[model samples]
Target: MTKTIIFDFGNVFINLDIEGAIKHTFNSFKIDALSEEMTAFNSFYEQGLISTKEFIEFYVENFPNISKEEIIDIWNFMLKDFPKHRLEFLKQLKATSKYKLILLSNTNELHIDSIKKTIPFYDEFKNYFDAFYLSHEINLRKPNKDIFDFVLTENKLIANECLFIDDNEDNCKTSKFLGIKTWHINPKTEDITNLFKLKSELFN
Candidate 1:
């Protein structure tokens, strides 16, 4: 039986303008495409291999004209509203105590700080999770075997008894490969409030 439900943060709980953010970043940097080194630097930041100050410095050094605040704004452009209804859904789920709830997100300090500042119920949303694993804090990320292993091992969970829900197909594929069930949700057409209805077979 599935006793655990692991969720992804972006596009799952909070809405994100992913494509718009990418376009904004490119426009701000005046670059046609992200160079390999820049992409590697972002990955390092996400994995907590570099400090936020270091991450900002890299951008400042590369794009000398952009101010610090502008860089921050560009970096945070992807984040959108977290609908209150989702919080209501999570609260109801937590009250049930039917399954262990966990949040596994690939997020960084700046983005989180922004969310906490803007979202009033951020703490409440976090408290509902039995385990909250942020890639920057854990120094691990999704779509990787090691991170999944960490979650399963740390929680003493059986992969087959867990359901991971992520909007990214690659991340879902990785979890499925590890014997866990997954929902590769499409944010445009789906809402997490219908979790039980959409994956009724697993719950039953």
Candidate 2:
């Protein structure tokens, strides 16, 4: 039986326009996508291996023309909105006493700051989770076995008894390898409004 639910916050909760942000950044920089640099920097930043200042400095040093504020704006452009319906769904899930809810997200400071501004009820949303783990704060990230192990250890949860939901395939794969049940949500097709249906399957 699934006694715990681990949720991923990006596309699962608030929508993230990663492609949009990349296009905007490329337009602003007047260059092709620096996919390699972005991937490397993101990995470091999400793992808490580098500070926000260091991450920004790396970008600034490579692209001399991009101002700090502009970089921050482009970086945060991916975080667009927090639909009220999603928040309501989460609220209802929290009200259910059947499962221990946890939130695990791979995100950095710039995106988080942007989200706080867009979602006025950020603190209230955060309060619903039994465990809230952010990649930057935790010094670990999704798709990494260590991070999954850390969460399991921290919560004293058995992998078989937990269900992890994420939009990323790699994350779901890693969790599955750890013996945790997973839901790899397809944001383009699946409606989060039907989360109660998932709950029924998980709980009943």
Worst ten-residue run, lDDT, model 2? 195-204
Best by lDDT: 1
lDDT score at residue 180, model 2, on the 0-100 scale: 93
Q: Which ten residues in a row have the lowest lDDT in candidate 1?
A: 195-204
Q: Give the candidate number with the greatest TM-score.
A: 1
**Candidate 1 local lDDT, 32-130, one digit each (tens):** 999999999899999999999999999999999999999999999999999999999999999999999999999999999999999999999999999
Q: Candidate 1, after superposition: displacement of residue 81 in Å?
A: 0.2
Error of 1 at 78 (Å): 0.2
Q: CA lDDT of 196 in candidate 1?
A: 89
What's the lDDT for all of these models? 0.95, 0.88
C-alpha lDDT (0 to 100) for residue 174 of candidate 2: 98
